[model samples]
Target: MSTAGAHTQHPEHTPGASVRRTREKGEPRFPDGPKADPAGSHFERRIRSFQPRRSRVTAGQEEALQRLWPRWGFDVDGRQRLDLAEFFGNDRPVVLEIGFGMGEATARMAAADPGTNILAVDVHTPGQGHLLGLADQHGLDNVRVGNGDAIILLREMLTPDALGGLRVYFPDPWPKKRHHKRRLIQPAFLDLAAARLAPGATVHCATDWEPYAQQMLEVLTAHPGFENTVADGGFTPRPQFRPLTRFEGQGLDKGHVVNDLIFRRVPHADQPADRAGGDHGADRPEDRDAAGT
Candidate 1:
C-alpha cells in the first residue's frame, strides 16, 4: 500500500531518509487512483495548481471534482466560481484549511459547530473518502474539500473577505537546503491568504518542523496585512473548537513540540486599498494592485 502516514521528513518516520525502501514502481497503493500513485508527485503536474499544467481537468473529472470538492472552485484566473449566496448556507463565517490529513481534526471541528463552514484541501483520495465518510457519519454539511494546491485556490479563485479564517497544520516541510523554494509559507501564499481573509480574519498555522515554524513567523510578521494574534510565540493550546487528532496525540507522546501561529488581517477601513498590494480580486497579478494590505 502507499505510505498513508508520512511525508518528507515527517515526524512519523523521520521524513523519508530512514526508510530503507520506498514503494517500487507498479506497486499497488491505497486510494488507488491517478493521484495516489505512490511513485508519482501529487504537486508536480500540480492540479492543486500553482505550476504549469501537464494534465487537464475534464468533464467527468470536473464532476468528480464537484462531488469530491466543497462548493468552492477557482476559475483559470483564480477567481471564485460561485456567488456568496450560493456557496454559504448562512452569512456564517468561513474557514479554509490547507492539507488536512485524513480528515480527523476537520471532522471533529465541523461536528462541534453548525454555524461555521471549514474548507479543507488535500490531494489524496482515500483521505478524502475518509473525511467524507466521517462527515457522513456525523451528518456534517459544514465541511468542504478542495483536493489540490490550496495556493491556487486561494490565489486565483477566492476574493477578499471571502474567508473568516485559515488553517494549515503539518504540511510537507520540504527540508532540503535547496528545496526551500518549494516550501508553501512564502510571500506569494501569504499575500493570497491575506486577500482572501476578512479584515481581522485569522490565519492559524501549526508545524512540528522547527525551521518552518520560524520561517512562518518571520514571513507573516513582515507581511503588512497581518499581526500575530498572540503576544508570545509557541503552541497555542489546541483551541476547544479544533479537535486533537490521533497524529497530534502521537506527536505529544514523542516529545515533539508543535508551534501554532495565529495572525489577524488588519481591518479593511484601517488598511487602505493600496495595502491590498495587487491582490484585489481573483484576476491574478493580484486582486489589489501594489498595495501591501
Candidate 2:
C-alpha cells in the first residue's frame, strides 16, 4: 500500500491545475456554511470536539483542492441525508473515517478493498488536499473526502443505519484533565455512531494515549447498541488490515502504548428501543465532548 513511486510532481511542477479554477467559475458550492471561529465564537454554540488549527495549504494541495473538491469533497453544512449511491456513484458499503491525518491509512484501506468506499473526513486543508491528490494519483475512485465538522456530517448528512463501518484512528487525546471532555469518543458519540451504523456494522478506534483508550473502552462497552468484539471485554490486537502509520510508529518509539477497540452495532431487533433513539446532542458551549465529534 506504499504510495512509493506515485507521481511526485511538486505543486510548482504539476500541470493542469487550472482545472479547478475553470470549474469553480461555474459551480455553486454545495453545503456551504459560515467559517468557525477560534475562541468558540459561533462554533462554540455547539460543544465541539476539535479546535480549528491554522495550517497553510501547499501549492499542490491548493491546486488539487480546486480541481478535485467540487467532485469529491463537501462542506460540513447540509441538513439533508446524502444519498450514498448518488454521492459515490455506487452503493458499495461506505466506511466513514474521522480525522484521517494525512490519509496514509485511509488510502491503503480504500485501495485494499475496492468493494468499500472510504469517506474520509477532516478539517485540515492540506491533509485533505494530500489525500485527494493521492486518490487521483492512485486512480482510487472509491475514496471521497469531506472537510468540516464530523459531528455535523454524522448528525445531519448521513441517515440512520447508513454506515457500514467507521474508523477513527489517532484522534486528539485532549490529555489535560480539564480538557478530557473534549475527547471525541464519548457516550453521546457512541450513541450517534450506533444510530448511523447498520446492524453488525463495526466501529474501530485506535489511540496511542492510554487514558483516552480507557475512556473509549468504558464508553463503548456501556453503549447498549454496541457489543465489543473481544471476548474478554478488552482491547483487541491490531488487525492485519490496519497499517502501521508513521504517527503510530513515532508513538511506539516514545514508549507510548497503543490500543484498538472494535465494537459491532447490534441488530435492530436486539436494540433496546429507548437506547436506539439516541439523543443527537446539538452545538452548545457547555457540552465539551459534544463538540469533539
Candidate 3:
C-alpha cells in the first residue's frame, strides 16, 4: 500500500463525499489495492480535489523517478500510521505540503529549511518526477514525494498533531460557481486538518485566483480551531521562503493579485474538548484506533 502503483477502481461512494458514477458490468467495484495505470481510471476510489492530467515526461525526468523515487517517494494508499522518524530517518519537524505542482516551490522550500522534513503530495506523475529530479540535483534528504489522494493520507495515515506545519499553494480554483464544492479548503477539510495539526502549528495557503482566495480566507477564519495570523485578518505578505511560481508570475504580469493566508492551530482551552489535545509528539490510544493499526 505504501508503494506507488495504479489506483484500484472503486465504483462506489468515496469517504466524506458521495459521488455518483457509472461503470460497465463486471468492472471492479471495490478498491483492492494500488493498481499502476497512469490513466487514472480509479477515480471512484476517492473524491479528489484535483483532476489527474496527462503531461509529457522527458527521458531525464523518468530516469530520475526510477532512480530517486525508491528513496524519497511514497504513495498515499498507506493505511498504517507512518512513523516520522522512520519515514525521514530523522526527528525533525515535518511539514505536509498538498498539491506541489511542478515542485519548484516545494524544492526551494525544502532547500531553505533543511531542518524541516517536507512530505509533499500530488497526483501529477511528471511533476512528481520533476520534483524528485530537483531533490536529487540539490542533494536534499529532507524532501519526500507522495502520489494519491491527500485527504485519505491525512485521515488514515497521519496521527493527530503529528505535523509541525502544512502548506497548500495555488490549488486548482475550480472557477465555475457550481464547481465551488470541489474546492479543497472546505469546512470538513479544515476539520481533518485541525485533528492532525499540533497546537501552534501553522497552515499556510496561497492562491492567485481571487475568488478562491476569498473563499479560503472565509473558510479558514470560520474554523474555530484556527486563528488568522494577520493582525487585521487580511492576507499576509508573501514570506521570503515562498518563491513566486511561474503561474503567479504570469498572473502578476496580467495584473492579478496573489493572496497568502496563514492560520495557527488554537490551543486546547480555546477549542472544544472534542477538537483539542493533539500537540506535537503527543501520542494517544485513539491514534492507533483511528488508523486501525
Residue 256 of model 3 has an lDDT of 89
TM-score of each: 0.67, 0.79, 0.78
Candidate of highest lDDT: 3
- lDDT of each candidate versus the true structure: 0.61, 0.74, 0.76
In the range 42-99, model 3's lDDT, one tens digit per residue, is 3346455788886655555555666666668776765567888799998877889999
Which residue ranges in model 1 land beyond 4 Å of their true spot? 1-80, 233-235, 269-293
| RMSD to the hidden true structure, all candidates | 11.6, 9.5, 11.1
TM-score of 3: 0.78
lDDT of 2 by residue, 95-119 (tens): 8999988888888877877778888
- lDDT computed for candidate 2: 0.74
Please give the TM-score that candidate 2 achieves against the real structure. Answer: 0.79
Instruction: Give the per-residue lDDT of model 1 (tens digit) for 1-293.
Output: 12132223324443112223355787633222324322234233542222222333333332333243333322222334534445656566678888777788888877866667777767654456567656766888777665555766675567767887788888777777777788888888887787788775677888888898889999998898887666564335445455677887898899977877777677666666555422312221111111122
